[model samples]
Target: MPRNLPLFIAFRLLFNARYYYPIFAVIQLDYGLTLPQFAILNTIWAVSIVLLEVPSGALADRIGRKRMVVIAAVLMVAEMALLAFVPLGSNSIVFWAWVLNRILSGAAEAAASGADEALAYDSIPKEERETVWPRVLSRLMHLTSITFVFVMLVGAAVYDPELVNRVLDWLGSDLVLAKETVLRFPIYLTLLHAVAAVAVTLSMREPPLETECGGEASLWSGILAAGRWIVHTPAVCGLILGALVHDSVLRLFTVTASEYYRLIGIPVAWFGVIGAVFAGLGLLVPRLAEGLVRTGTPRNNFRIVSLISLVGLAGVSLAIPLWGVVVAMSFRFAFGLLNYFTSHYLNAAVDSRHRATVLSFRGLALNLGFGILTLFYGGLLRVLRDGNPVEGGNDPAYRESLFWMPAIFVVLWIGWWYHQHRRVHEARP
Candidate 1:
């Protein structure tokens, strides 16, 4: 296997996904998205995944893995350009343009998903491929978190949060005055995506494989085969379902933690500190996963870690609002910690041939779950926000940005469902 392929994948994700999210959030703010509205946009991406995911997986295995990735990279660049160049103001035209970009992104994402895995699987010999895939994925995730944490820190540092407040204080200029800075946040983002596209184009490689991998089955067939595999292979399915539950919580909390803190009276400047803390703690996750591996019981360890995650999530949700976010954040580290081991579990599940496709399915599940949750969440926030329009509903604040009333509901709902699922699944005959 070529080492460059792994490096390329990491860089692609780092620049493509990691950087663009924060940028998207800022642009949506400029365009008239409320927190709930952003969730709606996220839901669109989620729904698109549901539509394209299985089909794309078949496309990768049938057509060519590397080709799809290249296409996705190109689409990513176009998407950023659309966001940057599109004129500001609201109306169906502007809103739908952004939505079109997201849908394109979703389709690109679907194509890219299976292709990269197929490419990576093809690059290595069968035995070595499975082991390498997880490590590659983990490194990519670590790079993404590391990159975003720093970007946010820098963005926070340069932009004065009080820009809005000062204008409000002097001009009594309610909001139109503060809009320019929020909109410009995308400029920095567009630049980042440009750099990311270059990195992907320059670095990505398609390695050859020994096995046949999967094939160009019909989209529906691919979907059905995937479903059958899990149904017949319950243990395999159990762990995957466990992972979905585990991952969604991880994404949701990480996405919104900073915003929740800000809302609870933590200052914007201090938000960087919270992010920094998350990045610093993230360093520990790999080591924790390593420790679990050393114990010689990855399966047992993952189950234990899932429970640990539940407790941590439950603790933060129930405690933070009551005690304040600073106190809640104190318990937040557990999610990051559990994530490392979860990665270990994912690595254990399959061999190279289906790595990307199966993993893409997992990605599909996680994203859809998030999108669905966000959709419901948006409704909840509207009820809670009493229908106030958002600065950017289509942005990051929707994901990790928080509303306490809705959050409490999410915490309870997720916790209850996780428990019920865990109970039923674990008792499987």
Candidate 2:
């Protein structure tokens, strides 16, 4: 019911709903960067987040969450500005400019990861949190879904010169936007959102921290304390572990969704529409997530997500013509459910002093898991390519990876479940 809660929701929407997300790769490539350079930039971005994620959370805990949020917003603006105005040629300067942009973007992501959630969650009255938090999350999910759908549609439309020129023609305007000009449109829109993020984050009221430490803790000390806490806290540890098991694989699938779509007979032109349809799932997914949270225990929820993930992975591996899209879409539900369950359980279990740090650990674990999976996938592709030189094994490698994902997930989930179960049993004395 506090002002910070709504502001937090608004800040998340603005910070995350980038218009260029639908055409992220295309925009980078259109800027004269090769695919290899693009991949390197992405790697830099990931490394930046991994390196800064936990430290930023500790800093947020040490300083103020609002300050970190504001920093993230500012960085968002700078990153987008780089893309919007950087030189077009494929020169070393342009590449370095993008590298700096990626670093700033990753830092922004790291700074915001746990700080924003901690700020908003702490703003709620303690007594009301049990009932109110779920509703807050559900509302956020719904709004984010709607925003992403709009961004996807409009972002993709504006990126295409033909689409923009046709609309201009219909309006009796002589302005014919070139691809170079239109390519920056999404970045410009995202810059506007970044500016809004700064405003919203600045307006947020910092909630009082309830420190468990004796006094102000150093960054290293805070990180160590949080790490130890997670090691000692079975519920929190289990929740994060379970989330990692599901989140990493689903995220990998999401990253490669376009490729999967192409292999399944979906045209490249319809990718934006498909993305919009995927985003639309947010409309109904939050409701289902909330219902499951209300009715199921953490164990039951984990099992449900696991089952959905397994089925979705197996079905997608079959690549059953166009209908496989349905199976692929199922991962969205797993993703939504896993995130909701993890957030709810982790927030309820962690203390305020280390809340953000613990959440950062969650982010860190998920990212590391994804990074490891990506490496394994890359290796799988390489092996497939080496084995068969005729077709380069691109499609087969992808399908083989997909086929293995379900089995891998199953093994990891069972291991995690058993480990948690054993820990619980041993602690019962």
Candidate 3:
């Protein structure tokens, strides 16, 4: 039941995200903001995360993890509800609302990140966390993928930015009712957030706290100490680096990939179908990763999976069709092979004493990846759009997204493989 909870929540998020995604895209259109404006908003979102990641985790330490998660869940529900109802079409109100939601979400997330990791770490015996962590995340995400795929089909059928106003016109409905109808998807999305918050509150059991000294240290001191600890282990640093790239690629797909599909003339409903196709791969690949782990270290399986994933991603970077995103997701799931592996590295490398501090930086590393990805993608979009990148959505520039992500995958994989090899030799009798 406990393991099933995260998977259920993951699906809920994707289901919810589908509704807001278009809302996010169309709000800019509604407000007379261009693509650049959207990018700027996203940039702000990323910055909020990057700035707050460590501090938020530290807050978790101070106030306790469960409190922060509950708070985060509350913020998510409020934020989504506010977006679904309020008409902020051309005002700073919408922008600031977005910013506030993201910051709060970050704070809430910070509390949970370490706590969740720690919780899962504790669920299994100390020896098993290495093996169990990846499976746990994969299983949850896999369950989420199946849930989201179906939800995507539903979302694609219902919530559409392009035809939303048109449907409203035909129904001859009042604007308020029409808008509320359009926002239904997000309301359900908010419900999912509430559900996740509740789940964490009730179902989650705390991981055994580390005996590490960082628990009592000042925030800055803890953060610096964690950084120092990270670089000392090849597998640990590799895991952190891989997570950043992994998140970047996934967010890029999550934030803008569907819009690109619509631009290419894939039907809106079809977009949801494609969502299933991509996410469906999530269900398949983690099981395969679990199979691979029976024989290899997390690092070894990571190398094998990363190489295959890069190949798949390269196809994604090249294809212009909606199916390309499907292919991209295929590769993306393959990379997940290392999640459990690297999780093991982090768990093993950190003494119980400073676990949350080091783990907070783990969250920080991933957020930094998210920040860099947005800036790069935003700049790339701007460049592709002839210096008016913010002038609303540009269909032609969607393919340009293919260029940046694949190369980064290559560089990170090579670095990770080298480190793994060196570590293996060092451990020899």
Candidate 4:
């Protein structure tokens, strides 16, 4: 029960619970950026994260984890400031500002990815970890879900000028805000959270390294060593592989959730409410995950998660109006469970020496898998579009894509499971 534990939870809440998340795409588009430009900016963000993920983790191992966490917090402040204060108009400058912002944001994400969790996990006494860590994780998840619901609701509400003006009127304010003026409101709120994260990170005490090998290794050597360790360690490798399968597909659906909602007869205005509901649902996940971890083996837990995903995806494919939202929402449970299980298992298996780097590898694999899936999805959409000009809209392609996702996940999961099983079988004495 060190101070780092609570600070770690607070830092995660502040660092990740960005108010702009609910209206991310809309804010960018409202800033005069076209959809194509928005897409390109996101691509840049993803590439930056992929490129920096492992290197940052390696550096965190060499340097202090607290140092990296502080750097990430500073970068977050800078990124949010770019959005908070960039002047309207001047398209070229604004676009470039966003580009720089994305790069900074990605770097921040990479720096914080493994270092924060590793730092916190290392703070606990070794003897108490197995019994205590699950409870800590469960508490963190519950708090995070509450924070997300608050952010989603407040963020979406403030993004609308009319909504803000109504509040102002009730408070006897004479000033009225315009759409452009209020568009940055969410960014401003996120900036405050970023600042709070910096304070929390600054206050954190870096626990003594559990392994002598942490600071002595070269960056390249550290990464290579971690890579080799993962390959040879069946449990760790299997955890990452299983996480990759679940994360990439679920994330793809999560990102395109708005379109899915529209197709399922949900109005655009209710999107924020739906998001809040989803976040609220996250409150139930940590308890269930804890119970599963206590009673079930990793194989059994993964099987349960796989079943939930398969059923949810199949139901989504049916595209039942309004009712399909429930099915779509079930993926949240699968996703939450997957995240908790992977974190618990991966951290438990990896050594403290290469902990951050291995976690970074997990992040890198998940991102790469998502990127590949996104490209495949794009190709699938194009093929669907070319095959039938009558249904020129994207809705048909989206439906077709939904229909195939579950099938694709099944094939991939089977292959992954078989490969892991073979590796285990061969390694046995």
Candidate 5:
């Protein structure tokens, strides 16, 4: 493996995801799909990932992380290619193509989920692993935020009709070709990002690991062992529960945030501006949370950060003005801390042989939470939107629907974490 394999992995992640995610909700709406329809699509993606997450993790541990990542990158390219070619709207063929694309995307997500982290952890020198791993995670977060800011600006610009028309005119495109180009440009751009990620993944090598990395056992046996470990391990189970609860609301917020901005009176074109601002603030989070990561127990960190996140979610759900929304969103700075500490804690608890498999258990829990929410929420959103149109930032039903339930979930999650924390400490010596 090259000395800079981590850098290459970072490069692939930096390019592979940012371009599409910032504009994802917008793309779905532009496709003439309602929120509920989009939620169903998300459910499909979650279901696909749920089915494959553990198996793929075990496969990565058995075969190699690099191979799994390469496979993921190829799947991503195929997914984007499907999206790029399919015309927008509720046409039967386009809808089915989008579904297929989401299924492939889910598979790609599962393949890469645990393998990247496991590979990165092993790649570090043993003597420096403790100190270096946090820094690597922090840098990765910072770089990812920076990439997000760049792509938000670029994606928003390209998706702007005026700019697209300007570019078409500069290229001397006929009116018909220009219209066609504008319609397809975003997907085409995303396809390029996917191809680049594949190239970058191909350039990297898997880090070496112990011979018994996935255990000298059958794949099913490996998975069973990992399941047993998760059930028996307090730290692992607690972390997974905490992550599922906290991330469920966060995931819902992410899916609807662009639309949330519109509901709060911010123009759609300015969504990128808000994203850039949030991403900039998000860059500072790992540094701000470093004290907790280095000095506090995982339970204590979760207690503190989960409280802060709960407050933010409440404000996001209740805030009435654009400035209020921006401030409320900024309150979510603790998100990165929650993410970092959970992964770090879980990694420390699990052994190397079953690390990927156990990590996939966490992914499974998350998808189950996400899928359930999407199904229940999708139907409700379908009803709310159909009855009341969103305009002039006064669609209380739609806006409330997005925030109220998630807020309730966060509150309940906070209580659950507090109980778990108390139980863990009480049981200690």
Candidate 6:
């Protein structure tokens, strides 16, 4: 594993999240932003990624995945730098800076999405593909979970107002403890993380090209081929679309989770603990999901995972107690493997020559759905909270808006199921 450059790089890259992701909403709120405002910022991020996903992906396919990954790392540094400079309070300058930060972060994410996975996939030895790839991927997930849990806990500890205030007093510093100061601590940590990520990305070697298409293809040609492939392949389209819905809802839920925690009476200080617990649960999910796949099939596994996600969303909508939130969030364990499974399926179905472009299409679909959902969710908050979006997460109207999410998943599930069923029947002699 140590010698596997791609896998090792991925594992190290996961630790680049020194900032506490679970408390991101709280950080925005501390900056004097409202829920709808934060949602809009996230929508902007999603929109940016959606718009760039395919073009960047096709370019990676045309060029090389490793180079794009290095570019993404640089973007990450820029994003963090922007966020770190965002002013203490809500103002035009602060808001726009944060918005720019989101855009940069989104671009970084889009750039790396398909390229990183493709690089890792192509790096593995062909003989060890079936057995070793999943194990390596699983270990990567575990590494991410562990790295995130540790980072979140440490960041949260530093971001804790009471803890920082006490230390400030003990140090006899003239600086008084402030919300902005505490919140900025995590952002500062990200600067170091970004530098490390850039270093790691720079050291990564691109795996040998395995595509049989000979020389590099043009971006337009790759895009055209990818578009046609999606249209022509029913299973690929269904799988990507289904994943789009599932992932979008889950992503929104995640972005707003800290707000939900606050609404349910949990303090910002406890968010890190809760996030760590959720990450721990995530560590167990893929293994459990694989066991289910062994007993059943990937089709059944998808249904079960989707059902569990629906249940989790419903639970989030209704949860009032801290324990309820914890239990509700724990259900995301099922989601840990959904994308890996979907990506595997998509990678298998697409030609290697256009793999990154098609994967980018999947990213574009997911981001587009998420951007639209963010707008709708923000609209719901505006309506339900009487324009006081700060309290929207606690609003019954917000919970009610989420009730429809399960139905969306159901519809996508049925569509995917029908597509798979039809394909199977057509294959019958």
lDDT of each: 0.58, 0.83, 0.60, 0.85, 0.74, 0.75
Q: Count the backbone clashes (under 3 Å) in each candidate.
A: 13, 0, 11, 0, 0, 0
Q: Candidate 1 residues 1-429, lDDT tens each?
A: 476566555645544544333333434644765555566777898788778876676566555566667777777777667766776666566678778877977887776765665676466666776577556655755775576577656554434446546745687656543545555553455556655665665566666533454544454565677667755665556555556666665566555554555445565555555555555555556655655666757457656655665555555544344246544443334555444555455546655545555767766776777777667667766665544444432333232334343344346446645765776687789
Best by lDDT: 4
How many clashes (backbone atoms < 3 Å, residues ≥3 apart in a chain or on different chains) does model 3 have? Answer: 11
Candidate 1 at 187: error in angstroms? Answer: 4.6
Q: For model 2, how does the per-residue alpha-carbon lDDT over 30-148 read when each residue is reduced to its tens digit?
A: 77764446556766777788899999898888788999999999999999998889877656877898999989998999999999999989998999999988989999999988988
Residue-wise C-alpha lDDT for candidate 6, range 143-214, written one tens digit per residue: 777877887787887889888888888999767777667778888887888887787777777776655332
Q: What TM-score would each prediction reach against the true structure?
A: 0.76, 0.90, 0.79, 0.90, 0.90, 0.89
**What lDDT does model 4 reach?**
0.85
Q: Please, what are the lDDT tens digits per residue for candidate 3 over residues 28-105?
A: 444445566676676676666677767666655544454555555565666566556655554577666666656665
Clashing pairs in 6: none
Q: Which ten residues in a row have the lowest lDDT in candidate 3?
A: 14-23
By descending lDDT, how would the candidates be arranged?
4, 2, 6, 5, 3, 1
Task: Give the alpha carbon lDDT tens digit for every residue of 191-232 in model 5.
Answer: 887787777777776766565544546677888888987876
TM-score of 5: 0.90
Clashes of 6: 0
Q: lDDT (0-100) at residue 140 of candidate 2? A: 91
Write down the lDDT that model 2 would get: 0.83
Q: What TM-score does model 4 achieve against the real structure?
A: 0.90
